[model samples]
Target: MARVLIIGASKGIGLETVQRALAAGHTVRAFARTPVRLVGADTSRLEVVKGNALKTEDVEAALDRVDVVIQTLGIGLGDMLGPVQLFSKSTRVLLPAMEAKRVRRLIAVTGFGAGDSKSSISFLQYIPFRLVFGRAYDDKDIQEKLIKASSLDWTIARPGILTNGHRLGTYRVLTEPQDWHNGTISRADVADFLVQQITDRSHVRKTPVLVY
Candidate 1:
């Protein structure tokens, strides 16, 4: 079991990963601004650290002695309309911190529309997606580039439309560019993949799309 530091551990896939990682027997440092929001998290192997992801000092402090880092950072819907920089800004802080701390493995959650996956968006969903998610995905593009350009052993998990469904423990890991497309996946299932990556390096240095 590794000491896994999960960024953005309060809600969504981050919270789900926190739970799943603990259940998997990994020591978890749940890092977030409002980490108390992680209600019912197992305290035995869980170290809840409240800090801002975009802060260099905060991220460096959180990276201490961790074997792997899983970044699931996100912003609220209210901020989606404006120019979004959370993903890129946080990555800018996180990557160097990980390298400095010698945490070589990183499994980051970037959605389907990020990086080359943007080209996989169907024509039908393009207009609305661009209208609503363009700003956010644009920053994710930067985030992907930054991660790719790093020296860390990284696997970028790009799940499609997110849901609050249960973890089925079975999902597709689409590694080929031709297989990349939009679909729906539960946050729990995505976290299942993230926790698995703590020791499973089969997907390292690849950005695979996840779906049911």
Candidate 2:
């Protein structure tokens, strides 16, 4: 199994990915500002590294000798309104670090309204989406552009409305622009896809919308 570095490994999809990847027998370095939550009895192959994703030194340290990188970084709801730079800024730090380490495979979790997927948002839902998630999603747009512009073997998984549901292991991987639409998906299922991408090259250089 490959050694996987999971950024933002404290909670949400990141935490789910850590569990899923470990269950799949991949050694995981769980990076987060406060990853104490990840300490468990069966942490034999898990390495919990507490660090800020925006710090160059911190991110570079987390990228050590990993075969693949899965970035599932997220910010709290409180930071959604103001100017959000976590996604873009950390990505700026991430891409070059990955290059330095020669870790070319990146599985980044950007949501449905990011980049071209913004165009897929319906006219009715567009207003509220703009009102609430506009700022964060805009930064995700920048994040997507940076990844696309890079030479890394990248697969962007744009999951729709997230929920705390169980992993059914069944969801739509919408690769075509016409099939890109928003719907609810479990964080576990998204993690399932992320783990699958560590070896699956079919979606490399492709951004697929995940939905149920």
As a whole number from 0 to 100, the lDDT of residue 167 in candidate 1 is 96
What are the runs in model 1 whose C-alpha is more than 4 Å off?
37-41
Candidate 2 deviation (Cα RMSD):
1.2
For each candidate in the order shown, give its overall lDDT on alpha carbons. Answer: 0.92, 0.94
How many clashing residue pairs appear in each of the predictions shown? 0, 0
Error of 2 at 200 (Å): 0.4
- Scored against the true structure, residue 142 in model 1 reaches a CA lDDT of 97
lDDT over C-alpha atoms for residue 30 of model 1: 92
How do the residues 1-212 of candidate 1 rate in per-residue lDDT, one tens digit apiece? 89999999999999999999988889999998984465576678989899999889999999998999999998778899899999999999999999899989999999998999999999999999999889999999999999999999999999999999999977899999999988999999999999999999899999999998
lDDT of 2 by residue, 1-212 (tens): 99999999999999999999998999999999984465453578999999999999999988888999999999888899799999999999999999999999999999999999899999999999999998999999999999999999999999999999999988999999998999999999999999999999999999999999
Worst lDDT run of 10 residues, candidate 2, spans 34-43
- Candidate 2's TM-score: 0.97
